[model samples]
Target: MATVDRSTLAGRRDAAALLLGYACAARVSELVALDIADVRETPEGLLVTIYRRKIKTFTEVAVPYGRIPASCPVRAVRDLLAAMAEAGHTSGPLLVRITRHGHIAPPLTRGGKQIGDPHGRMTAEACAEIVGRIAAAAGLEGRWTGHSLRRGFATAARRAGATLERIGRHGGWKDGSTALLGYLEEGDRWTDNPVTGL
Candidate 1:
């Protein structure tokens, strides 16, 4: 079946993580380190705070509720939050350990003491694995990782004619970065060079 049973809490959270990762061009560590406190609604859109390891600083970015409902990060995140709230989760890690059976139950039953994720925060390895798994399922061949999302962002943005400076800032790269140099897709956007046209 092409249908997904998003009625399940685990399913909702997974979908949210996947969509948010792509929309934000997130690093795996950043995605797993996310907390309920890091997300908020601003006048512009849904704001996501990403803590960069290289700079050791937090940067907030916005993800629009795209026209496509199925792939919308904003809607996915909102749905996940609602599901978590219903389960008595007010705060803590946004990414959690999903059991083999797809349950998000706390690991400990004694006194209902639940540490964030109970099973513990989702590891970067797990995050990468999920990205690859989802890609394969979508019929995409070749290896994919958490970094793949960032690379995909750069390639797509470049192809769409977004400036390198804007792409660097969006990816949280240091100023005047060549970080995007290797991520460019094979193409010449200026073949119809605007300067020549002018």
Candidate 2:
């Protein structure tokens, strides 16, 4: 996020998206589906309500403040909200597409013409593309999609000594998920390797 220039609206929004998405361990669909009204600020952190299509239910994800102010998800969200409000959008989509010229793109009609709706939420594809674009900008070699945030969250949390059950809950994974267990195994490999301390 340090590489991203927050001086522009697009940059600010991108930073917020990346931070919030990772902090919430959200799928791309859940991340993009969020609205300004879905996030509530608390004294400790943020409470984000996301609808899970897989389970067909709404779940709340708690995102606490980061130790670093620059990389803080809470701060990023607050900054984005302030910028959005200044741009006359106090509600609606939390993440919207901004043109190269920095104006929020209006919604398009089925006829491909711009519609009256000023708050045009970004598509899941666009959000994933943004993740890849930012990673490339940072000179990262591996493929980086929106799912990377979810995986990265699991890996990081495990490394930080978070329990599997807690990690799974944070990521909205089903109980005893094989996919969630895979991350725990991966996390352990690094610390438990026989090659370590060699």
Candidate 3:
């Protein structure tokens, strides 16, 4: 029952991360590494260009949400862009810095030019920590991770009556089966259970 509540700053950031993860169905690493230019508003919804080192491929994916609204992923992207602009960042990486003091800041290049930080992009460890912190803040109890956000979206969308084919396509899976597998395996385990449903 780890739902994202976008009220506080941390909550908003965590919600932004969750929404990005789910909307793109992106791996946490990819989600964190995303650059400002990588996202664009589309007539259909949003288009996200993903680069994965392990996959060694660039993927163009679309997230179909009704248009770019204030509450949508586009807003998150805009906020990030604004933050970067405020920090005088023009390019390089995206996720920025995760300070030991728990503060998030922009990264700088060797020449002291403002640059985005790839190191702060959501890693498995960072994802785990964020999930735990968000869960605790929301007063929810359960195992959670970056993968949970993606799985939650699939599962919740399916339970809300979204078609598997639609979810699969939006999630950028090669097939409905693959999407369904993650949806069922990772999502259903939490939502479908008799107890602790969100």
Q: Which prediction has the highest TM-score against the true structure?
A: 2
C-alpha lDDT (0 to 100) for residue 24 of candidate 2:
91
Lowest-sum lDDT 10-residue window in model 1: 1-10
Regions of candidate 1 where Cα sits further than 4 Å from its true position: 1-5, 107-119, 188-198
| Candidate 2 TM-score to native | 0.90
> Per-residue lDDT of 120-196 in model 3, one digit per residue for the tens?
44455675577567667768777777677667777777777778887766665555475356465444665556586
Per-model TM-score, in order, reads 0.83, 0.90, 0.67
Off by over 4 Å in 2: 110-118, 183-190, 194-198
lDDT of 1 by residue, 125-183 (tens): 88877777778777888788888877888888876788888787777877777666877
In model 1, pairs of residues that clash are: none
Tens digit of lDDT per residue, candidate 2, span 90-161? 889999989889977767676877664456898888889889999999999988998898899998898787
Clash pairs detected, candidate 3: 96-117
Measured by TM-score, how close is model 3 to the native structure?
0.67
Candidate 2: deviation at residue 142, Å? 1.0
lDDT of 2: 0.88
